[model samples]
Target: MTVTRFAPSPNGPLHLGHAWSAIVGHDRAKADGGEFLLRIEDIDGARSRADLADEFRRDLEWLRLDYREVAPQSQRVATYRDAADSLRAMGLLYPCRCTRAEIAAAATRMGPDGPVYPQTCLHRPIAPGPGVVWRLDVEQAADLCGQLTWTDERRGEQVARPELFGDVVLWRKDAPASYHLAATIDDAADGITCVTRGLDLFHATHIHRLLQALLGIEPPVWHHHALLVEADGRKLAKRRDAPALAERRLAGEDGRSVAAELRHGLLDTGISFADTLLLDA
Candidate 1:
């Protein structure tokens, strides 16, 4: 069965962007006679909130988006740990003691996420203690996997370049698994056939493709949608205080109407796609 998912973090209230992504996944699944699953990505211990997770359910109900719930990521740490263990057994994961500040100081190039890690700890001896992050050796993994590509529903075939991110962290000191590791493991474990998210995550698919190869998991087709941005043309972000959908509901706005407006690209600011930082398709 073709399965798509709408995975959201429980760190904040749902915004218009979240609603649009959920609607997109729901409609796609319905159209293909498949299933739309919901997964709560609350692996970040520092930011995740139980109350916010409850609000996520209410927001989805308000939007009338029904889905079968997959096991929450917070409860799946063991599964992720096991996957990491397997990768370690393959010699693809290595312990890194480099701190964030250290990497920032050493990095010379920037990728979509941030500074491309310079792999300072790739060959360094593993520290004899905890709090060590495990980074994937992208170059070695790519050499073993050889040329790889993935299908993007809109852009067609894309050659995988996992090295672009340069040895991304699979396991973190603060958390058992990083976003890239957890998302890939859950998607494959849950038998997801199609992955739908925003274009901001398009580059992430490259590293995911490599992980899927090394882990011997089935790869899913990707659909990267344009992100919803603010009137000022910056991407909508929680840090920037993007208006919450709950606030709109509190003001007596209909969820269906909001979904409709989002579908048609109708926003209060009337900004076009070009106005935003849309990357090349």
Candidate 2:
């Protein structure tokens, strides 16, 4: 059966964008008679709060989005640790002492996204160092993957160009698993066949695809829906409360009215498929 998931970070209150994503995931699953799962992506232990988790539960329920089951990421550290351990054994993960300052300075000097790291730590024969962050050895993994192909509901067939994205970090020093690893593992475990989320994650597909390739698994079909944006044309965030749903509800807005407004706004954003195709290329 086709399955989909709405994995939201429980670090803040759900907003209009979260509502749109929840509706999309639930409606898509209902249309296909599939299962919809709720995943709590609270891996950023330092930032996640229990109150935010409670608020998320309330907001999603208020929006009437149902799921088969919910998996809180904090409980799945062992799963991620195993993946890290296996990669460490395979030499695909390396311990780097690169600090945020080092990465920031490197990127700034490169003048913008300038291939941070320059793989300075790649061939270093140094022993496991302090602030050791685990990075995926993309070049070697690409040699194994050769080529990748995945289909998307909205974007059609997609190809990953690892050459464009060099070795990416899979786990931070303090976190056992990064967003890419934990999310993909959850999807595969839940047998999710469809992934419908906001377009903000389009760049992240490369990282996710590479990890899936390395783990020898097939990725789910992607449906990167246009995100809900504020009247200022900025994408809504969980942290920012520019146009939160709570405010709308406080302003006496109903679900039907909100959904209609969002649907209209999404298609009327002056962003046409033709334009997206050109830009995505």
Candidate 3:
């Protein structure tokens, strides 16, 4: 059976964009007789909160977008560590000690996207810096998987150029796995044969696909759906101006109304969303 998940960060309340992503993820998997999992990606300790996590679960369940299993990235530290160690053993991983200022200076000298590390620290001592970030060297990655191709159900044939994803970071200096690492690892472990997510991450297909190749895993079939946008035509974000889902729910608006608003908001984006998903809620 196919498996897919709607992973959300608990730093803030779920917004209209999240609702749309949840509905599409759950509905698409169910339609194919697959399992839908709920993953709480709260690895960022500085921003993650128990209260927000509780609201995350509450919000999805309140919308009736149930999942077969639930897991949190915070609880999977060992998994990330093991993966990093394996990459290190393969010599595909590097410890980067560059600070923000150093990077900015390099950028100023080399031009934007400039300085790109110059790979200065690639073979040098990290000099016991404040923090270290683990990066996967892309050239080594490409030698492992030449020319990867990902076909999304909606966007079709997406390709990742080797240069764009070079030296991608997998973990921050503090040992917490970056979003790129945690997400791909969870998807692989959960048997997610089909991955459905928003279009805003549409470019991530290349990064994830590259990571899959480096990790000796097969890329899952992707389905990048239209994103939930605001009236100003901006993509909705939790930290920004998107309407809060919890607030909307508490303000006497039912799930149906929220779903309608989402569908209407995404009308120009060319995706079919059903209001019936809210009927049971």
**Decoy 3 TM-score against native:** 0.85
TM-score of each: 0.94, 0.86, 0.85
- The per-residue C-alpha lDDT of model 2 at residue 201 equals 72
Please estimate how well model 3 matches the true structure, expressed as its whole-model Cα lDDT: 0.74
Tens digits of per-residue lDDT, candidate 2, 1-281, equal 77888887766667777877888888888887888888788878678787777666666666666776666888888888887787778778776777667776665233112444656688776576456777878788777778887776777787876545456677777666888788878788778898887776765676678778777678888888866555555676655654456665657667666665655554334322221321233
lDDT of 3 at 28: 81
Q: Compared with the true structure, what per-residue lDDT tens digits does model 1 show for residues 159-234?
A: 9988778888899988789999999999998889989888788888988998899888989999878777766666
Hey, what RMSD does candidate 1 come out at? 1.9
Distance from true location, Cα of 180 in model 3, Å: 0.8
Candidate 1 Cα misplacement greater than 4 A, ranges:
270-281
Question: Between the candidate structures 1 and 2, which one is better when assessed by TM-score?
Answer: 1
Scanning candidate 2 in windows of ten residues, the lowest lDDT window is 270-279
lDDT of 2 at 77: 86
Task: Please identify model 3 stretches exceeding 4 Å from their true place.
Answer: 108-118, 127-130, 264-281
State each model's C-alpha RMSD to the native: 1.9, 3.4, 6.3
Residue 141 alpha-carbon offset, candidate 2, angstroms: 0.8
Q: Whose lDDT is higher: candidate 1's or candidate 3's? A: 1
Ranking by lDDT: 1, 3, 2
